[model samples]
Structure formats: structure tokens, C-alpha cells
Target: MLTFLLLRQLVQNAQSSSSSETVYLPLVTQPLIQSLPDAQQNHIQWMLDEAPYPALSAQAITVNLAEHEYLFLIGGGEQFNPQTGRLEQTSRVTRVELDENGQLGTWSDTGDLPHLPRRLHGFTATAVENMIFIIGGLNYPAGNSPIPRFNNKVYCAEVAENGTFDSWKARNQTWKINADTSYDYEESMAYHAAVFLNGRLYVMGGLRRGLYFSQSWDATRYVFSAEIDHSCEDLVWEQEETLPVPIRGHSAVAFERSDDKISEQAIYLFGGVTNDENDPTAVSYRANVGENGLEEWTPQAVIPGSAGIHAGTAVRSDEYLYYIAGTTQYDPKQNSARDNVYQTKILPDGDLQPWKALNALEYLYGHAAAVSTLGRLYVIGGAIVTNSTQMPLIQNTIYWTPLLFFSKESNPVGMVFPGEEIQYRFTIRSNNVRDLPGLVISDTLPTDLELVSAPNFFQNDRLLSSIRITLPINSKTWQTYTAVVTQPEIPVTINASTATATETVLPTNTSTLTAPATPTSTPPIRPTDDKTCVVSEVAPDSGTPRPKPTCTPTPVVTLSTTPTNTNTPTPTNTPTPTPTAMPTAVPEPVVVINVAELCFEGRCIWKSTAVTAPNRVYLPQIAK
Candidate 1:
């Protein structure tokens, strides 16, 4: 015991000598408390510095209609007819899936929103739990109508089983403008930002246009929070509080963080417009979510150069919030919002850290932004804002980014030639701050290739067409496959044609179309010995001649030379001519020409002779 105490004292003295360094003592005994002197602890902390965060490059992507995991840009006016300057609104639902890696994908169209396909814009789609609540946007314009009717309709869509988007169904609002319940808030406003936090839907900052308002438009300041009723079927809203200043075209993001002990959540507001404001508004405000209720709004950090960005959208990550492209209102006439992406961390003091530029986007307005559960940010359709167009010319373009902390690489750059043996390596390295799960990578080889060698970690036989890999977070692994390429052979095409006699000629020729049992090299000729035209034919009593073929070999030929007295031809016997020349190349199906001479212009032209022996078909001579 005495020796152990002396050694401990020596260790403490050594640690004290080095005040700039932090030394962890050994855990030799239970409940052994070790404390560093206050001065030394301070000095050690002063020497330490926080590590820089690793960032990956983001990519702008196009969305596809049939793909899943896409953030849907519900309804907006993009099909603008430049000729009439008439703005057309569509109820079309556009969707885009976020890539796990920063890669581009195309946007696709899906089923339209049910019910009347009203032109919808200036609305907010807030995802709460598994449901996306779209609240408050412009429904109809003053197209041959008395005034513009803003839609206060509330709709909610549940995420499908595989995380694909589903159809939205209308949910009736039980809340009203006044206690009398005569006026409904859901039917009167548009261009509002809505967010779902703490099991309640918060709708704020929208424009209500009607004849009742003095200026025909009201930038609503009243904030409304809605919660499901006991049956979870109907929504009950309460006009809780109002904003310090009501602004339209602003974006709000709800961020959940840890306060060391309890979970902390807050919503940050950035950029909007008031009635009198000339440019896009840049006011930043924050509201804290507490156990009892939401705290009062407090001013937070804004984007560095401008007041705030309007039309640009914002999405939240685990520790940071990203502000995407919107109209930059530094100049009202040239409100060109450049393609820009900015990010800021949610600090412990409930304040956002200094804004930093992350990526850039094409300038646009009237677009939407959404975030998937896997930290993918999607920027939906908006117009490319140049100094030229009077209206925000809409684009059907979508961009997506997968903010991955780790990096993946595959080797063997280009073409893998047939019969060439090669090795392919897939390496993944983790530089992420946190651990991740469901990290799967799938690779499918060409059909002809065969895998000869693979790592044991890569499961399956050598001939597997596809291999999937799932990696743990913050770890590195490599997979290699050695394969031999095998190219497939292509079959040749042949010309096959039918032989037919002319119909106008009465078809009197002995026409025989039969494939021979044995292939012949030359055309068939009549058999002759000296002056005697000897005829050799199959005997009538012959039953099933030897060397039978798939088709009977019938040949017809006529004697061209005059028959001498010693070479008289017999009635039942005919000499066999050589078989018709066999086709050298493979035969392909071809069109048959009429095998008849033209007797029309007073000239009766003929073809060849008739009767021959086995396996030969002959043509009769033409009398011209």
C-alpha cells in the first residue's frame, strides 16, 4: 500500500510539470477520483483547438418522375406561354430523388394532385413525423375574375412504405378567424411559410388578398399553430401570437439540437417582404421550443452580404442549415438571385454561426426546397432570373445534393475488352464526424464476364451478376474482383426466297420446288451416251428410295437435241440431269420474281426446257 501511494504521487508530480498537456490517469481502483489543478486545467484547455469540419462537394441534379425518395415540387406555373405573356398554372406534381452520392438525376412527372387541378404557388410543404403538410398558397390568379383568390386549404400526404411520395388528401380545418366561426382562415391567404414542430403545425407570414382589406392585400402577422384532435382526424388551430414584422416570400426551418441535458428545437426565419418594402427582405428571427411553450422571437444571424434572400429556400441538417437560391433584391430592378448555396451551424446559444457559402445555383424564384431523412437537400423548379424577363420565368429543373462525410472510389477507368483479365477495386474511406448505417453499395458485372477472385467479405459465387455492400460508419474497407471477359458471338443473317412460275402464262411449266437431299455443285444436265439419249428414272415399283430427304427430290427436264434413231427416248424412262446449282451463301427470305417471258409486244419470249430425273428441276425453252 505504501509503495502504491508513493508511485501515485510521482505520477502526479510528472503530470504537473507538464501543465500544457492533458494526462489521463490509470483506473486502478474503484471510485478513484483524480482532479487536475485549476491553473493546469486552464492552460491545457487553452492549448487545444477544435478540428476543422470536413465538407464534400455538392452536385446539382435533375429529377425523374418514376424514381422514389424524391422531394416533390407540387404545383406551380412553369409552362409560361412567352407569346401571349399568359402565365399558365398546372396541377402537375414533379418529383426528384436525391442521390446518396453527389450526382445528377433528372426530374420526372407523377400523378397530379387529386380534385380540381388549381394552379398552386406560394405555398409551404412542412414535413412532420411521417406526414408532409402543405399549407396556404396562391390558388387562382385574377384571370378574367374580379380578384385573385388565395387558397387557405390545408392538405397532408403520408410517406409511403418505401419512402416514396403518395397522394395528398384534404384535411378540414376546425379553427376559424373569430369565435363566431363564421370566417375561415384557410380560405383567405397564400404565399405563407409553414413548419411542423413538436407535434403541432405552425403557419405564419402569408399574404391575404380580398376586397375586405384596405389595400386589397394583407401581409398576415398573426401566427397560427394547429394540432390534431383526439381522433387524429381533424386539425384544431389556435391563433397563438403574431410576428414582430409580417413578411412574405420568407423561408422558415425547424432545427432540433441538444442543450447538453434536454433536446432543444428552434425555428429560424430569413428573408421576406412587407407592403412598403422595395427589395427582398433580409430580417432573421428565431423562436425557441421549450417544454411549456415556444419562446419569444429573437433576431439571429443573416446571410453575410445581403439583408436576407427571398425566393431562396432553406433546409436543415443535423448541425447546420442550408439556404439555397432565391431572388437577390440588392437592386429592385435587377433582383437577380444568383445560383448560390450558403450554410450556418446552429450554435449552442440558439444563434446560428457565421454564414458560409457552400454551393451555387441558378437564380430563380417561385421554387421550393425539401430535405429527405437521409440529409439530401432538393431544390425544385424556379426560373432562371436574368435581367431580361419581366416575370420569374419558371424552369422545370431540379438540383439535389447528398452531403456525405465519407468518400467512395472505384478503380479500372474505362473499357473492359473481351478475353482481357482485369482487377477492379472499390474503396470507401470515412472522414465523417459521426457513425452511419445502411451504407450499401451495389455493383453488377456484364453478363459475359466471370469473377475469378474476390475478397471473402464480398459474399456469393464467382458468377454473381451483382454484389451489394453495406458498410458501418466511420470505418474503411476495400473490395476487389478479378474477372475474365468473354464476348458473345453474333449469328449471321441469310437471304431465303421462294421460286414461283408466272400466273399469266397459265403455269403450264413443270414447276417443282424441292430441296435436294445432297448438295450439288453445278446445274443439272440431261444424260446422253454417244447419240443415244438414255433416260434413267426411279422405278415405279421402288418403295421409299434410298437416301431419303426432308422433301422429295423431283426433277423435270426436256430434251433439247433431236432424238436420233439409235437414241430414241422411252415413254416411261427419263434421264436425270445434274441438280440445280446449290446456293453458296446461306439463304435468306427474299422476294420471288415472276419466272415468265413477256409475250405482250408480239414477241412471245420463253425460259428453258422441262422433264428431268431425280432431284432436278429444269426450265422449258422460251419461243421468242
Candidate 2:
């Protein structure tokens, strides 16, 4: 019979190919390949030879490990082509592998995922296991304005040694997580914060879609809210705690250590926007979401400069978290990128500290990425902020900054006490007047700190902005002391005309004291010199006024050469009296530049000294 003959041929082929390793199968039953026309086949072959394309424009970071190193699996987000008015659905997993030798390489395409594309989701590898779990993201339409398509389902996958990846079937409803009572649509948010904590994955702060539709603008309603959920292995989502603020495009990192592990460990959050709508004025927050769903936040701390969405961050260790690139701020009304890189540190007390203006990335309003590896922080691809107002384009770039640990070598130099007068000085040198600078310094005063004296500072919009102020600290109130300095550019030039002598104030308690200006014509005063300060006394409790500091010993400006001209008269020399009625004196500059070799979360971080103009040695100028 035909079957008998085929079986005999198959056995013969197997035995014949046994020595060769690759055995051939009989073609008697399997379907044969359907050949196409010559021209069609050529087109198909050309398509097959092309390189793989990415599925999403903006995607989150996820990792799968092999042989102790990491393999990044990034995918799923929204993509739009403004020129073509073309919007594409993005939902696929792409792998970039770190090979056995610790080199980065890409793997060939495997297969499509079980689900379609969605944005703002959570994915993580199982603890001590080779399994990966992905849950909840919004599935938007494939067009310019995609909204309302939210994916609440959860999925998992495992990869084998042979480079084959297959997703596991959806987990059954072993545990169901319901929506938070305070939030109507807890499961619907994109670009929210998700982290694997304590045996469960915790999610917080995302937008709520589907509340408004184009077809029913009249019936429109707003349900923007914050949520935290755990306790589900499948489709069932149980809501836990509600976030104190609504946020999106935020990043979270978990700190795990053995000591006081239960309550002491925390998940710190950075830069994000509020609610579903985009507003540049919106502020960001930092909080701790406990295992029991209890949320606690530090007293409000604003992101110092221009805050933006989708910024990148790297957790160098437990205490120091660095934020890099992102759109500076979203003015949806204008639809442009607010590109800027703002970096700040979070104190152990859970405060959402302001971004330090001194440190900024090169590109502005672009989606910057970051990661900490081998004791250093690596920033990866993101768009740069350029003619954002004209033509916004995606940027493929890479940059990095070292995590400088704080040290006692560069300890903070200035301090303020309650109900006390303090003077701080800041100086700027310039080779050209066109080089403009701006500065803002804030002090963390005790609760009862008083600003009896207004800020008296010099600001030349065309040249420089510098200040030295003296403030009265309230003795009854107490808090940490802090300040910030922002300049148009770092490493300002020191020209011959610039004076190196800056005001110096000793710690003192006083009523109305006038300080005589140091003589510039004399040799510069040394730091060791003990000098007297003039006084126009006014009792603290009495209602009386006094004359301000006067021009005693006149100061002179001396140029190198004297001109021999008849028409031009020699410039007169007069001692310029210090502006006594000037607003509050600028605090004397005693910036604590502490360099510490700290061990944070089992890694070393070096905090470098804060220099004049440029705070760090190699940092780029902050793009306004």
C-alpha cells in the first residue's frame, strides 16, 4: 500500500541521515510551499532581507537576564507622524541582549505577543526565577488622536535556552483586584509608576481615560485620579491605597536592604505631570506606598526649574536618585516639548526636594533615559530639545554623569540660625557683558525663620546676576538649611576688570549694623584678617530708623594706562558707598561643597566639590 511504502522510505531516510545529525522528513503528508510569480517572489525576498523596525516611539525599560547579565526587552507605547498625519499602533516586544562575554547585541525576531499594543503598563521578571510578568496598559487607536483603549489584562512569558519565547496563558482569577474606592478608573493609566516590591508589584499615579469622548462632548465628565493596587495574579485587580497626588510619566525605584526591611525600605518617585491633561505649571511629588496601602509624602517640594514629563532617572544607590532628560513641560495648547534635564536628590526623610539648577543635561524637552551599572550611571537614547516650537523630532542619543558621592572634604560652608543676621556673598566674573546669568537661592529655615531684610542683589540682564544676602533666622523654629544657584552658563570668565574680593560676614546677632565697604585700591584682604563693621544702631523692639552705611574711605577704579588726549578728560575717582538701603543683604557665599565616599545600597558614590560657575567638573551647560 502507499502508507507502507512511505513508512519504509521515512525509516530509510532517518537511518541514512542519522550519521549527519540533521534528518530529513518525508514530504508525503506535509503541505508543500506555494510558489509565487517571479516578480512577486523577488519583492517578498527583498522584504525578508530588510532589518527589523521598532514597534514603539516611547517605551519603558524592562530586563531579562541570561548568564548573570541583563537582556533589555522594551516595547509598547504611542507613535505619531506629524507630517503624514499617520498614527501607528505599537504593541510588540523587542530584545537587546547582553551576551556571554558582556557585550550588547540584538537577537533575531521571535514572534508577536499574545496581546496587542498598549501604553503605560508594568512588566517585571520573577524574583529569583526566569519568568517575566506584564500587566495593564492602555491600548490606543492607530491614529493622531488615540484615546480610551485601556488594557487591564495581565500576561506572563518564559524564555528557554534555545532562544525561543512563549507567553503563558492568562493566569486564572486566583485573586481579583478591584478599583480603588476613591478612584473610579484605577486600572486606566499610562506612563504611571510600577515597581516590584516585597513579593508583589505595586502601581501608582496614572491618567484615567474614556471619561471624555469626541462623540459626547456634551455628556463629558472628568474622573482623573490616583491609585495603588496589589493582590492579583490574574485579571482580577484589587485596589489598595490612593496616591496623595495624580501623576503620569513618573519613575519609581525600590530600595531593599536587610535592616528594618519591612517599614524602612521605600519606593522613591520622581518627575511626572498631574491628571490626564498636560499643563506646564503642574508640579511633581515623592511619596512612600507601604505594603498595607498606606501612602505618606514629604512636605511639598517643587521641581526647581522648568518641570517636564517623561524624564529619565537612575538610582545610583538608596539615597541618591538622579533625573536626566524629558520634555521640559507640556503646553498641550501649543503641542511642543518643554525640554530640559533637572537633577535633584531626595533626603532620607522622604522630601520631594527641588531640582538643583546648577546641574542640567545638554538636550531640553526630550525623553532622556538612564540606568546604573558597575557603580556608574549610564544615560541612554532620548530625543533632544531643539526647534521644538518649530519642528519637533525624535533624538537618538547617549550621555552619562557619574554619581559623585557626598564627602566631608567639600562640606557645606553656610548656615543660618533663628532670629540672627547673616550675610552671604556670591560673585560672577565676565569677559563680555553679553554673557547673562540668573540665580535663585532658597534656604530651608526653621519653622519660625523671618526675612526682615529683603534680598539686595545685583542683576544685569545683559551681563550677570549675583547676590549676597543676610537673613534673620527665627530661634524658635528649626529645619534643615539648603540653597540653589542658577546661572545662564557655567565657568563664567574672569576678566581683568572683575574683582575677586567678595563680602565676608562673621556669625553675629544684631539690630541695625552698617558694614563699611572694604577698600578695593588696597591689597585684597586675606581670609584671616579680623575687621570691624560700622553700625547705624536701631533697637530690635523699638520703632526707629537710622542713617545707612556711608562712603568713608573712597574706593578708586584704576586702569592699566593713562590716556594722553586733549578732548577727553580723565575719569574722576570717588569711593562708591555700599548700597546700605539695598534690600536684604545677599547671604555670604559659603556653599557647602562636601565630597564624601558613601556606601549607598552596597555601592560607592562620590559627591564632588561645588565649584564657581560650573558646580561639577565635566557637566554641560543647562539648556534654558
Candidate 1 C-alpha lDDT tens digits along 1-624: 332354357445654552222223332221111121122110111111110111011112222233334444555664444555444655555434444342334545344334224556666665555555666666546554434466656676665534454456777775545432223365656766777777777877777654453646766566777774322255777765567786777778777766568678887887767755564446688988766556788878878654545666767755667776666562323656656667777777778888877534566665666565545455656665455546444555545543332221222323333566656544443322112333443344445556677653353442322243343323555555666656522112222122223322222335444433343344546554324233344332243232322443335454324332333332433444444443333321111111111111122211111110112211111111
Best by lDDT: 1
Q: Candidate 1: lDDT of 237?
A: 74
For each candidate, give its TM-score against the true structure: 0.53, 0.45
Residue-level lDDT of model 2, residues 1-624, one tens digit each, is 343355456545555542322222222221121222222110111101111333223343434344333443344323345564333444555545433212345545646433333443222222213445555454545555534455555555565544346655455322233443333353444555556655556666654444345322110112121222332244344555545556666666665544453345556666666644445643444445555643554434555543545544434333445555455444322344433444444555555456544334445332424243332333433434345254343433333332221112111233322224332232221111011122222222212222333344222332112142211111111112222332211122222122234444444433443444444455433343333457674432243443454434434434323333325333334444443332232222221221212233323322122212112222111111
Error of 1 at 433 (Å): 12
Residue 444 shift from truth in candidate 2, angstroms: 52
